[model samples]
Target: MDTTVANTGTEGKTWGGGNQPLKSSYGKMMMWFFIVSDALTFSGFLAAYGFSRFKFIGSWPIADEVFTHVPFFHGNYPMIYVAFMTFVLIMSSVTMVLAVDAGHHMKKTKVTWYMFLTIIGGLIFVGSQAWEWGTFIKGEYGAVQTNGGNILQFGKYETVDGNAVFKRVAVSDIAIDAHGERVEHERKNGLWFVDESALPAYTVDEVYNGLKANSDVLVRTQIINDEGEKTVLSREESLNQIKNNGKLVVQGANLQVNEYGTSLFADFFFFITGFHGFHVFSGVVINIIIFFNVILGTYERRGSYEMVEKVGLYWHFVDLVWVFVFTFFYLV
Candidate 1:
């Protein structure tokens, strides 16, 4: 018996093992693959964040309260700077679109300009994120960590529009340093291989004394009450807590402590945002490389600006990821 094979009519078609499968080049297809994988990674991160947040929803740091800072401006402007960063990042995506369009049209000058604008926007966003991180780590108002690891903030309730609102009071404002000759423990000073962290600005005794001196100040626990506000303790309760349960004064956020609320919140904030920031920074660097190539007539000689379009895909993915992050991390 003899067997013979016949060619089907689908030869050279999209599914016929063509070089450009589904009308996409190999490079473009690879970029899409990378994007999909990266997207799944981000989804996993955000999902984990959501789960952790749900688990600690009551003691979670309020985004508005935590992100209430604007560069070169002083006041309680919640989400203002973050909103600005989002806007800049989105506008950079728009510029990337324009750059890709210009590349398709073979307009090198337009592509160059748009790519430059996109780079500038990325730089601005990265810088703003750095500033925000600095502010978060520095912490505005400090709090006391109870022996139970609960964070207790200080504030006073003020009437606004006939409604009571709690205003944050800085630990520096109320805490008076009374301890003398306090020093950080070094390896040489104590254990030969162990070292203690930096000393807090004020001791618990000093904080207790200061709270006693200030009649209006009250302690605010991280637990949210029925009215969707942090549970504020009465003066007597506040003093009792500081005098008995206060373990240490937390002035900022770190891997170990967070003045805003739980240390887990700070951990997630640093990890997720830092990961996203790394993506943005990488995109910026890649765009800079592609921008120089565009100026050098690299794509023009090839008669196709597919390179720009590929990088644009990555840039757009970064921007889109940030939208979800901003929503889940800030607005939600």
Candidate 2:
């Protein structure tokens, strides 16, 4: 006996798997669903960042001061490299769009070239972000952390272009470390498994003495004033704070201490940006896979270029997410 079920009234209806409700293929629709879910995830993270930044509005690290390094030429070019990275990512999205358009026209040569450009753009962006991470980890000017966990940056007030600007004073320029023979705490020497990070380049005493010796260099407190800038203390106040309240010398950014400002700022920076960077890197890998397949004429032989369109959706979503990330982290 054959046990074949008869087709119900919904056999040819949208309820069956045969219908394209949104005028898209099953794969494209699923990609859209994934993109929507991922977007919500990013929104949650950025929302948390917004709330934290709002709570600590005053002492937040200034983006201009924080992202002031270029690859080779470095002279306080604030936001230049970051802007370039943004531009590159946006351009990659543009190239992806071109590739999708070419795929629609069945112009394989055009698709190949545009996809190649997109891959190049992605590589450049990922490399630039890695360089930025390195620069941020290896801080430019060292700072002294107060007993209250405040970051004290040394700078001098200089008149430039008819306005007074805060010029950062390098620790090496101002601090003279007389004490030598500093050793890093290790597990072998102490707890048999516990280990500590290397000591800072300068001791608190050295920074204090440097503050006292330099009359021009003043301490810029983390607190922001009504003028929308960090409150630069008077010379006398600067010396007094470092002499009495200075606890440890912080060199770069980490989970424990941040030479730039609050430790929470660095924590969020690392977590959020690192997550986004991972996404970008993943997209690049996927693009490379798809790129190779295109060269092999996989989609061409299948009589459909829908794979390019599907990946383009993901690439565009990634680029859109970066725009919001840029606004929150750098512009805002």
RMSD of each: 6.2, 5.7
| Backbone collisions counted per model | 0, 0
Writing each residue's lDDT as its tens digit, candidate 2 over 184-220 gives 8888878888888778888888888888888899999
lDDT of 1 by residue, 162-188 (tens): 998888899999987786757888988
**Distance from true position, residue 291, model 1, in Å?**
0.8
Q: After superposition, how far is residue 281 of candidate 2 from its true place, in Å?
A: 0.8
Give candidate 2's error at residue 184 in angstroms. 2.2
| Superposed model 1: Cα runs more than 4 Å off | 1-18, 188-192
Which residue pairs collide in model 1, if any? none
Cα error, residue 273 of model 1, in Å, equals: 0.8
Error of 1 at 46 (Å): 0.7
Error of 1 at 207 (Å): 0.6
